[model samples]
Target: MSGRGARGDADESGATSGSLDTVLSFVTGEMAFDPGPYNDAYLDRRVTARIRRTEAETYREYRGLLEADEAEQTALLDALNINVTRFFRNPDVWTVLRDVLAELTANNRTVRCWSAPCADGREPYSLAMLARDDPAIDANRLDIVGTDIDGEALAAARRGEYETTRTTDIAEELAPLSDLDAHVDRDGDSFAVRRPVREMVEFRRHDLLREDPLGEFELVLCRNLLIYIDGDHTRDIFDGLAAAVVPDGYLTIGKSETLPREFRTSFDAVERGAHVYHHC
Candidate 1:
């Protein structure tokens, strides 16, 4: 296809069937997993974004570059996945989480939680903070697992470093509960979560679309991840997430996401505005 046509086609339908087939073949051949679960529009955007970054003249050229360069393949995979996240994002949601966790662990000594697609560890780390602060819950008894498909993001999570700008909003959100400084150590332009908080979370590489549940948990946070996936895959993923939650356990999704119609009867809304639900 002509370069202009390729660009125009991407804008209209993400990619021509032939180019998409080429790209998908290359990715699966190299990465050993299908990118088919993601929405065409989402894939198109990421593919075009990578094309622009590489300054390739056309989709054909871009596919050729991907086939030739292992580094480009990795870069394209990273680009296709969303990794933008922060600590204590949407404070109100955290508040709902805190209340639910408090109630869930009211009679128990241990509480387990999972944060799927926990990019950079901020979300699970935030959960760790709540567990540490709750008087009814013992920090020693709290176990939080953070899983993501991106090794790079997991590495950053392990490093526990963040720039001041990234933590500014988090700091503001935490000011009402406790001093943000107490949970993070500031050094120069970056800050790191305290060792105690970091210790509460364990990071692992996981693909929600293909992998089994990390294990049953009392709470599961799979927020801001479903929007990029197509409908059938989204339902498949939701089924896995629902099964991962213990009976009466809680599941929380992104503010903008909702439970699929098939799942609405199985999970009761605990906090509809916050997208928190109870597995029935």
Candidate 2:
């Protein structure tokens, strides 16, 4: 749902130029949400879905509804920011991460990590669990931050809980590094991250496209979000990511994503298939 391009660019999704402008303007001016960095087709699809759900005949009417209803505005923002994630999402990549974490914590210093666009806290909590269970790592020195533009998702993350289905992968691939007692507590059909793991992590609301990198980190996981960005803005986002990682620090992107051509030299691929990089 993130891309950057001319607002007047032709869109065959059926939203008229004037009406689309009206909607985008209100979102930017009033809500402080910038839609300019989102792909047009993706934005159109999300906006159109909202329009249909609200039964608004035109984008202008949708804007009117947005002005009148705060809840609808939240819904629209949620719709625009699509976040798909799961715990220990890619086991192989996480296998590589095991070595990375051990190496990062070898200095016995605080290790800072960021999970950008972290949906519902699964990824960062997964990292915490890994750090906590691994005897070689000092879990007390771990500082993890999970950020996303979706207000609702951030709230869910702050709760530090997830449905049973969301945690199935832990049993499948991360059982060795997982300490259910110290990391999670199961209740009925759901699970909540235990105090030890939850203490190491914090969640914040951040917009990658509109805001600066939160700070430099030893590890940054900006997985799976670059696919939706347009080419020009993709480079910009990648640059921001590069800036966020300390020299020789690690940056892990989605397996499906590649480093933009210009960044190939600046970041050496530590594990090409896992999409782990060492910033130079």
Q: Pick the candidate with the highest lDDT.
A: 2
The TM-score of candidate 2 is 0.79
lDDT of 2 by residue, 1-280 (tens): 2223334323554356334666787888888777766667777778778988996777777888999999999898878778768878888898888888888888868889999979888899989998878887767767999999888889998898776565354444346555566677777766778887887889999988879999999999999888777677888888899999998789999998888888888888887699999888
- Candidate 2 weakest ten by summed lDDT: 1-10
Candidate 1 lDDT over residue span 150-243, tens digit each: 8999999999888756535545545534557767887876778899989889999999988999889989999998988888899899989988
lDDT (0 to 1) per candidate: 0.81, 0.81
Residue pairs that clash (backbone atoms under 3 angstroms), model 2:
2-38, 3-37, 3-38
lDDT of 2: 0.81
Give per-candidate clash totals.
0, 3
What ranges in model 1 sit over 4 Å off? 1-22, 30-33, 67-71, 134-138, 165-177
